[model samples]
Target: MLPVDTTQLLKGVLDLAVLAVLRDEDGYGYDILRRLRTSGLTEVGDASVYGTLRRLFNAGLLSTYVVPSVEGPHRKYYALNAAGRGELQRSGKIWQDFASTMDDLLRERETA
Candidate 1:
């Protein structure tokens, strides 16, 4: 299949993506980056993930804490707060509805 230009698409959904990941568990910067990649967001960048984390924290959607590491400096872990959870729910529903519409459109095109 042709490669999709996910940059624009991702820009709109990065907040939802990052929040969704943290919903399950808290993670440090690099850990969150890895999770995003492992979960098939291969084009996601580290800077984008870090920036999203900071933005979400500042927006009161995320809570953060620092944990000391033996191998390096302390790591800051991020977790979802009540506001974040609510945002996630809202965004997820919007995404699902939009995706369903897109699927319907694509199927129509295919059948035309």
Candidate 2:
């Protein structure tokens, strides 16, 4: 299969992705980045994740706190607030619907 431009696709879904990660547990910037990679989003970058965290926090969808770290400076952890959780649920549903439709179309094309 041809490679897809995941970066372009990720632009619109970054919020949902970040919120989804925070939905389960809080994480610092690097920790969140690692989680994205672990979740199969290998093309995701550190800068993009950091920016999304800032935007989500500014939009009041996420909350943040600092925890002291022995390895280095204090870590800023992010968690999904009620608003973030709501957005995650709504966006996940929309994505699921869109993906299902795309899958149906692809199947029809293959059969034709």
* lDDT per residue as tens, model 2, 37-92: 89998999889999999999999999999999899899999999999889899999
For model 2, the superposed segments whose C-alpha errors exceed 4 Å read 1-3
Candidate 1 regions off by >4 Å?
Answer: 1-3
Steric clash count of candidate 2: 0
How close is each model in CA RMSD to the real structure? 1.9, 1.7
TM-score of each: 0.95, 0.94
Per-residue lDDT tens digits for candidate 1, residues 1-112, read: 9787898788889999999999989999999999988998889988999999999999999999999989989999999999999999999999999999999999999999
The whole-model lDDT of each prediction reads 0.94, 0.92
